[model samples]
Target: MKTYLPQIERRILVRPNQTFGILNYDMDNAYPQRMLELVAQSPTAKDCWNKRAKFIAGNGFEEQTLGKQVINSKGLTMAKLLKAIATDKALFSGFGIHVNYNANFKISSVNYVKFEDIRMGDTDSPETAGKFALYSDWGRKTWKNIMRNKITFLDSYNPDEQIIKEQVITAGGWKNYKGQLYYFNPEVDDYPLIEADSVWEDFETEAGIKIFNNREVTTGFLPSTMLFMQSRREEADNSTDIGSGINTPSQLEKDLGTFQGAKSAQKIIVIEYEDESAKPEFQPYAIQNNDKLFESTERSVEARIIKGFSVPKELINAEKASGLSNGSEKKEAIREFNDNTSPDRMELAEVLEELFSHYCSNINPTNNWKIIPVPANVADDVIGVKAGAAINQLLQSSVPTESKIATLMYAYGFKQAEAEAMCTP
Candidate 1:
């Protein structure tokens, strides 16, 4: 068992203000009584001693407390001695130190003694150490008092309240539960059982799983896979202030879209322009890392990776798609432009191209340059020439060719405009 000693220390200080006055007189006499009062307030001091008696030679709590052990075993009375040191300030009021108890009793070496013993005066004692520990000791005691009755686990054995309550004391003590006072049954009405500790029900496929509702579910248990449940408690901490970061509106605007699974992590692209009046006005890019949201709008077609790697784990081509061809981000953009609402083919096509073209405008051409939305062969009824042929011939136009290729790349992945350069060449 881990134990803690009262937080106590030993030290010697001589004050020039009251070196040999009434202060010295009080230090030598008035401290022991005050030390007695502090120990008398320890309700659990005796209980702690009973829990660990065989180790020391003494009876009752005081004899076992570090101070008393220091006294009875070593014949030292630092508690009274500490009182002498604090004689001038009533209870050592001006010093930035205090002592207190831990809710969980401790058994360790805690002492408060000065540096040197006076040859012309007298020796130090545990009474003085006790005086110093008194500082934090009292505060710790009160805190422990407030935190004493928390519930850690209640049989919650059967998801049934009746069984949990009947077994509360059996499962041990209640030391960390709070909020709603009931657990409901699994089958039938799900209404809470009055006064029952908790109810067992098969919430997830496992049998006899114990669970709770109403408050936060922070703790859980598994009993031979036969019975399972969780326990929770209200929070008791605070956040610290220490940073200079601030969030802006533009950063959050792109999280408003859906995603495709098989990928994890979402990326939104925002473009900052010294001049937003360019002909294209603005470009949009989005990529999502979700596996459960991929599907077709109306039909499907055979597609292939014409030139680059597959979707990256994260999207990094948004600025390029939005018309900022810096090319440093060479990794294949992991964004997808799935049109679920089945918008008009031309409309969806336009949207997809705008999204990708804006993204590619930022890819690193010499090193990381790439293309995506792998060209697809839709073997269905066509508008004019074969679907594949029409796009092939179209992309075979100019260096900064028609918008179809850009739109197509935007809709799927981003590839460089080297295709347009190829067509014109």
Candidate 2:
């Protein structure tokens, strides 16, 4: 006996390309493109991805440039760069920034490069790789005939002062020299997996279930019934061999096709036979109790996808917040998510600060770099009182120090350390 099962397709399959001198992101060298397409198809997954990106970016940088508001000739600002990199990092677990240098070997400008447009240079080992390849059509159908002028080779980001000066001197001028690339990857050598990779299959499953439900509804939940009809006698001129069985489609079959969709719902199907003993038999397949079919599976898949993203459900779905008695569910969710993503924000800010301090003179490093955290946006319960007003009132009250600390920690969105310090005697 032959058995069949549903086939599932996965996108991430890293390999090296000797011809192009770059590491293929996947089998087709388009893992990022594939992941972008997949996420676009799933509503829940896309929402979670957007949320992650927003939380990662938070507010703009804490310190501003001394003289220049824009970092590059293209007018890219620090805030815009942060938003673009945060979006890429949230989706691909990696991002790229193109760094340019002037003829005097001084850093000139920087721009954001799409993660999908970059590939690691192929080498004996990732550590030894010193180049990166950028091509926009890596996954497009026209990739095979991609124009040579469209591809660019860039040097990997090297903070070593000696190495950079040596390379600049050897190249003679910045015009002929390949620009530098600052590629950030959470993983060291291997390509980083997407944020919610473990639940990617669930993305497909959820989409499939939704499509199935829509189709069933379109057909008005019609039964899967089969019709059996005896052979009808043909005229002398139309008579053919019975054993041939190569009969053309009957009128009944033609009618059935027209009866299959929402437009044909509630219409009656009639069958007529010439011989009394040749009546047709209509047999309905086992009628499934499909009212609840895949309902639990859909919920399970949705939960798994959200869990993979590490975002609380209340944050994703505002409707769920209506059930909370204290109205603090969303506030708590925002605080929790911000805390969870603090490391990502810190990593990005530190890298930018380091790069600016080493190369760019306009940015002030001593001012301290910080990416503002996502606000809890919780309103005060007392309508007339403002944010700090309630805290002042609580402090002046006769409440115990521990009670005041607890109120600050829970009622307001303050960390334990911060609340403790604020309430200290």
| TM-score top scorer | 2
lDDT per residue as tens, model 1, 269-315: 35343443421232334445222222221011101111111222122
Candidate 1 deviant stretches above 4 angstroms: 1-146, 150-152, 156-412, 421-425
Q: Which stretch of 10 consecutive residues in model 2 shows the poorest summed lDDT?
A: 318-327
Global lDDT of each candidate? 0.24, 0.77
lDDT of 2 at 412: 70
lDDT score, candidate 2, position 189: 68
The count of backbone overlaps in candidate 1 is 68
Which regions of candidate 2 deviate over 4 angstroms?
A: 1-14, 63-68, 125-128, 141-150, 159-162, 165-172, 230-255, 263-282, 321-326, 358-368, 378-425
Clashes of 2: 0
Q: Can you give the lDDT of residue 236 in candidate 2?
A: 32
